[model samples]
Target: MPKAQETILEIDRSALTHNYNYLKSKLQSKTKFLAVVKAFAYGNDAEKIAKHLQWLNVDYFAVAYTSEGVALREAGITKPILVLHPQIVNFKTIIKHCLEPSLYNTNVLNAFITVANEEAQTNYPVHIKFNTGLNRLGFWESDVDYIINKLKATSSIVITSIFSHLAASEDANEADFTVNQIKSFKVIATEFLSKLDYKPLLHLCNTSGVINYPEAHLDMVRCGIGLYGFGNSANEDKYLKPIASLKSIISQIHKIEPNETVGYNRAYVAKTYEKTATIPIGHADGIGRHLGNEKGYVIINGQKASIIGNVCMDMIMVNITTINCKEGDEVIIFDGNNKATDLATSLNTISYEIITSISQRVKRSFIE
Candidate 1:
């Protein structure tokens, strides 16, 4: 609770526990939980977060790439990691780390089958992704038979789960679209499962899907942002607790006369006598340049101070003329109270973008 001597991100383990529990409460008792820990656990210390989640007994873990899965393995994470987007080149490495890859297309599917055969892997677990509606990365509905035929030709790998992504589960207006996507996945699952002798797990729900569509919580649920205290909506946000807070210290205070400019390109010219404070965080630190010129503000001693000018790579000046604060005072970028979603909303973005945008250079302190 002390004033930050330098820029630091505090990760609260208890909040994470609360979020996990809350999200779990929405699912059936038999449903499994998969924690997505890619992007450095959404840029909040992946090793620590995964360790804690593992201790909490999550059923599985997911990452965006093969290298991320490898990093988790190197960090001593033993839970099954589903690489959402595994490249062909990393298939061998993925087998080496015992990480599961989501085979979404013919190219990746065939390449992985070959790699698995080369590695002499028998019954190695993998997941198949179907394009319910996402249109991003997934196999079409008509590809079920093709996929089954491909699997029949290979004994090196086995389908451990069948899944798809929901494109608009968080938007109420997209309810019909989300429902149809679920229906499509069900049809695909029926055809896909009927051809096999065994039943691989069927899952589609992400964080918002877990909350909004309980019927779609098939066999397991995957949660990323919700586990970090964002439910993708205000109504649900209150039920969760944000686990990370970004804080910095005021480097110096400035008293400027009228017409005095702040930062580069003279983007902010003082129209009246103003006081500003320089902060040691900027675009390079994932603050982004768009949050400059009053678009973004930091909390100082419980008062909001608008950013003065262009966001520098290493620093940002904020107008603290009305704030009765001095040098070395605490500056809050985003905290439990000043949610990252709020900052993101100001710039027409989402909470996930804002939170994950935090740079790795910042010191991370975790509350165990």
Candidate 2:
């Protein structure tokens, strides 16, 4: 590996391909696979991941916005792209790039209808997102008729897919709640499709739903975290490989005497003489300040090293006395052995926060 000048996020494309194939094998042969590559492919590199997935013949790609979809398109990705949370203001650009938008509100639906008609489009593909239980985005069940009516009024707008999100698909204890959500989505979707005289592709299973509720897998599945080797369950984790690894080199090492304080506000007061290795990464680089004050740790030489004090804007101090490490040694922030989920648990957050929180400032390196 090249010498680490700064914190680097290493992306494993082979592991990503493995995860994609594993998830694809779990679904029925007829079921299509939609790879979600939003949030810079969850803080890795979207264009890189999308290119690899394209090589794997992924059925579709989904992003949170039109800009993300455009990025993939510009990267020569010709596969169908779905913008999950598109805004009306970008409807023109979305259409220009042949990107499909998930119409979750009446205003958005109307705006798309106007644009489609003005553009003289016929049978333009779009997804309708229903609010199952997430309550974040998506049209409510009561809005189904309005959506169907609007679509019926315009031949330009075509319903390509209908989907919903599961709020707690990974929890076994939330099985009943998830079941209820699936049932509700099915009922609303069935009623709307019956009125339309045609059926669009139906998909509700995310990574968690694909693992926990096979029955909920409808016409397709959208796998995001699963493609990145996080299944939200121990069983799934065993079968997956993390597609990203974060590593940083120790910039310098200092031997501190007993009673000496470390970092800002004297957050870490040494009780005994110890060696500290300062790494070139910090909250500004998405490590977060909460990771300081001994709240989180990184792995060095296969052993845990705790953060000694407040995480600076571009540096962190790790107690490395026991590790026998020196300056320029590589430290593992999160990887296959010590997962980011472990750090998230320590900081009382989820792996998504830990992964997505990684800022663009951190350099990204792709390993094929």
Candidate 3:
């Protein structure tokens, strides 16, 4: 690998393909794999990743907004794109880009119908989002009848799939709650579809759901984090490989005497003579200030280096006394060896936050 000028996120396409194949092998033979490319493919370049997955014959692609789907389309991706949290204002743009919207409520559904009709569209694909237990978005079970009735009245809209999100699928302790939510979703889907004389593909499995609840893997599975590696459970981790590796180079080195403080606010007072290396990465680069002050550390020369003092907006100082390295040496922030989950645990956060918090300023280099 070439030397990095600053913080760089190395994307391993081989690992991505490995994780996708692993997850695919775990799913039922009839279930389709929908790669969730929202949040820029979980902060790792969505367009490129989506195109690669499309080449691999992925069943579908999902994004959080119509613009995200539009990006994929612009990249020449022809796979079916599902917008999970589309706004009413973008319904026309969504229709124009041939992106499917997940109508979470009656208002969105009605608005999409109007736009589709005005555009002289016929059988435009749309997904129905049901609020199983997340309580964040999606339509209520009671509104199923109203949704079906409206769909029946409109000829331009077509229900492509009915899906729900899993709130606590990763937590084994929440198994009962997740099971109940799955049961409720199934009941509502069955009752509502029967009344409409329709059978849209039913799906309600996320990364953790697919791992924990095999029976809930109905017709499709939407996976986001698993594609990037770091599964919800320890067992799942054995089968997944992380695709992102964050690396930075040491910008400078300093020799500190005993009792001397490092960085702003004198947060880290040296106990003895120590050598610290300042890396060209900080809060502005997604290494939050909170991660400083002894909350987190990085790997240097195969050894752990404690982050000393406040993490500046553009730099961070790490004690390199134990490591046999000099200025311009490489340092690992989070990678295959030092998992993002481990860093997130040290910061009292989750892997999702650690990965998604990576700023766009970091240069991304993909390895095939």
Candidate 4:
């Protein structure tokens, strides 16, 4: 395939299927799968990714905001889209789009109920997020009584699922904490079931939770990073193929004399003569400012080139003195050869940040 003029994110559809099937293999036959397509499918075209996942027969889809769900609905995605963190102001829009909201606290819960009532919605599907230990979002265990009372008084909305998030499922040191979170969720789920006439789907596993804690698979599991081809662990990562490849082309090459500096703020001063290749991608393309001046490197023609100076808004200069390459030669910013996780580690972040930080300005090319 020909390279685009600027940086481009190449998404492999087959890798997505491979990751999905690998995660599905860890689940019980009856467990349903919810693919988290929020953040534009981790910054890789949500509608395109969701369409493929839907065709794969994924049982559900989830997004962090209401507008994301609405975008999916506009794209003609008929599958149930769960708005994980819906706001009170958008309750009407959420209802109008037929998007299920994750009612975490009393205010959001009550407001959603009011909207459902006004719209005359009956048994409108909604998910309940319980704060097991993450403490980010969800109802607390002590609020069980309040939750039951609220549900009993409202036929306008129905609890489709009761779920919680694991704060550290990937960390072995925090396994005990993850277990406690699971136990708390189970207790809360049981209490909810005892009060209600019907049983909603129960889920607590994210991508890491799915690979690390199989027993807590529950009724449905949400796969986010895993679906995008990362297992969050070395062992599991070996089994999954990274689906996104960020690529660019060298725009020009420059010969720098000794004592000559490169990029903004004179970030790099050559102690000796050096050859630098200017690539058409930088902080604006999600390569953070801190990733400049030898902090990060990119592969050009299968050779490693250290980033020489500060990353500019739309360009980066790489030390390519030893590499045999020229302008227009292909460069892999971060791909299977140089994993996004490794890049993230260098930046003290995660693959999610590295991948999702890629701007919309960069073209996205999908390969099946």
Candidate 5:
């Protein structure tokens, strides 16, 4: 990829392909693959990422909201786009875009059925979500009968898949918990499918689950972070490559004298003389305030330059005294080398939070 001239997120398509293939290798040949492109494909340009995955012949695509599904539809994603969470208000728009909704609860299932009837539709495909362990969303095991009966009343809608979320498939300590969740899902699936005449696809594995649980692969798998090049474990990370590289150029360099202060509220005071570089990226650009005052560092001329003082809305000052660098030099916020995982670890966070937090205002360039 070319050097950054400004604050830009470089999207490496080749890395994305490699990650997809790596994850795909873990599944059975007949199993389906659903690529989760929610949160603007984890804040790396949804349309672009979705389009590339579509080209890879991914079986399906998943987004968190109706708008995201609609965006995929508008981008010419003909392969099924699953709206993981759909508001009742957007039901009509979702139908209009041919986006499938994951009916997780009584209200959503009933509301979607009503909308399907109003639209005068027939066999409109939808997915069912059940809460195995993740209490965040989905219906309970007891709701299976209610869902079956609800579906029995409507020819306007059809269940395409029944799925659940894995709470902690990545953690070894949570192995038993993960296994129980998978077992619960299997029991739910057996009962749910036995009642219906046709069989829809069943999926429960997220990225880490895809690696850790082969038995839970069911009929399909949904991959999100893994496609962005994070395997959720050190053992699996070497097999994948992160697709987004946040980079910028040094706007200016300041030579501070002893006792000099920097940034808002004089957050950093020079005990000894130091040189600082102002980078055109900060809180507004998704660089959090917690990263300020030496919590985070950037790669300058292959050397570490620790971030100093408070992070401003659109700029961050880094102490680069020892680095032999100047204005307009390339700066690596996070890349395959100084990984996003490393940055997130320093802040006691996860790679998912850090990558998805990248602001939309930053320019994007694709390594096609």
Candidate 6:
């Protein structure tokens, strides 16, 4: 709420806690919770988010890469970290940091085994990902025997969990597909446990999956966007508090005549006398060019101000003619009232794209 800062991303810790508790309320007491803090916690500062979740006693933390896990460890994150897409070269670092890698394929499984053995690690914990239906990652269900054979061939890494991703748990039309995917995962998990002589945690729910498929909440659940206050559905979004609010201030105001044009390529031509407000945020700041030329709008004086002209690398122009706003007036790009989901929908995208696309250069202010 600083008056001078041109652009700032405000992170509400209370909202995050509220979201966590709300999501937790939906789960049984014994089901573990894994907070996905990958992509810098969806560009909202993963270190801070993870630290808060750690204090809340979240059962686990997951990231998209080993480097993300290393960053968390360096930041004093002591809880077990799961690297979702760990690379073979980073296996040593993963072991050094005591991070668990999701071995989705035979090559990665074998490569991680080599590293764990070389490091003299015994019974190192690793998670197995099954290709239930996503087909993006994970070993095939048909390859379950091969997976078990590989695991039995080595005691260097132990199976800690078997998980997979849900592609469309949020879509009501895909209910049948989601159910089938869950069924396939259950069969694979049961076979794996029967063969391994040990039971690893089973999980197959992301945010949407957590909401739509409670029965599939085997032993744990992974939540990413839901933790940040987006449910991917209007009804669910009504119950979640968005944690991040992207705000900025009008740096300058201009008066233009009917003949005048604005921005690169003269994207905007005034139809009449118009007042414009230049905000110090643009494509470089993650408000992409796709959001320009009246495609996106900002809230000024609690009124909508359409973004006019093309978005520049570090600035954007909004038609503030009717808002009666001056330089330094606060402008909210997206927040609870003007939801990021709505903004992304206007751009033919999703809330995740809009929220995570916020650039790191923008200052993040945490509110507790």
TM-score versus the correct structure, for each prediction: 0.99, 0.97, 0.97, 0.98, 0.99, 0.98
lDDT of 6 by residue, 1-368 (tens): 45436699999999999999999999999999999999999989999999999999999999999999999999999999999999999999999999999998989998999999899999999999989888899899788899888878888989899999998999999999999999999988888788878789999999999898899887999999999999989999999999998999999999999979999999999999999999999998999998899999999988999999999999999998888878888999998788999898898899888988999999999987
lDDT (Cα, 0-100) at 30 in candidate 5 = 96
Itemize residue pairs with steric clashes in candidate 5. none
Candidates' lDDT values, in order?
0.94, 0.91, 0.91, 0.91, 0.94, 0.92
Error of 5 at 151 (Å): 1.5
Residue 116 in model 1: lDDT: 89
Question: What TM-score number comes out for model 6?
Answer: 0.98
lDDT of 1 by residue, 1-368 (tens): 66789999999999999999999999889999999999999989998999999999999999999888998899999999999999998999999999999999999999999888889999999999999898999999899999999889989889999999999999999999999999999999999999999999999999999999999999999999999999999999999999999999999999999998999999999999989999999998999999999999999999999997999999999999899998999999998999999999999999899989999999999985
What tens-digit string does per-residue lDDT give for candidate 5 at 211-235?
A: 9999999999999999999999998
Error of 2 at 305 (Å): 1.1
- How many residue pairs collide in each prediction? 0, 0, 0, 0, 0, 0
* lDDT digits (tens) for residues 1-368 of candidate 2: 56455689999888998899899988999999999999999988999899999999999999999999999999999999999999899999999999999998888899999999999999999999999899999999899888877877889988899999999999989989999999999998888888887889999999999988899889999999989989998788999999989999889999999999999999999989999999999999898988898888998888899998999999999999899777788889999889988898888888888998888988899887
Residue 70 lDDT in model 1? 91
For model 5, how many clashes? 0
lDDT: which is higher, 3 or 6? 6
Please provide, for model 4 over 1-368, each residue's C-alpha lDDT reduced to its tens digit, 9 standing for 90 to 100.
Answer: 56545689999999999999999999999999999999999989999999999999999999999999999999889999999988899999998999999999888888888889999999999999999888899888888889889878988988899999999999999999999999999999998889888999999999999999998999999999998878898898899988999999999999989999998989899989889999999898888888888989999888889997889999999999999987889889888668999888887888999999999999999997
Question: Can you write out model 3's per-residue Cα lDDT over 1-368, one digit (the tens) per residue?
Answer: 56566689999999999999988988988899999999889989999999899988999999998889999999999999999999999999998899999999878888999999999999899999999889999999899888878877888988899999989999988999999999999998888788866678899999998888999999999999999997977788888998999999999999999999998888899999999999999998889988998788999888999898999999999988888998778899999879998998887888999988888899999997
Model 4 segments more than 4 A misplaced = 1-5
Query: What does candidate 5 score on TM?
Result: 0.99
TM-score of 4: 0.98
Colliding residue pairs in candidate 1: none
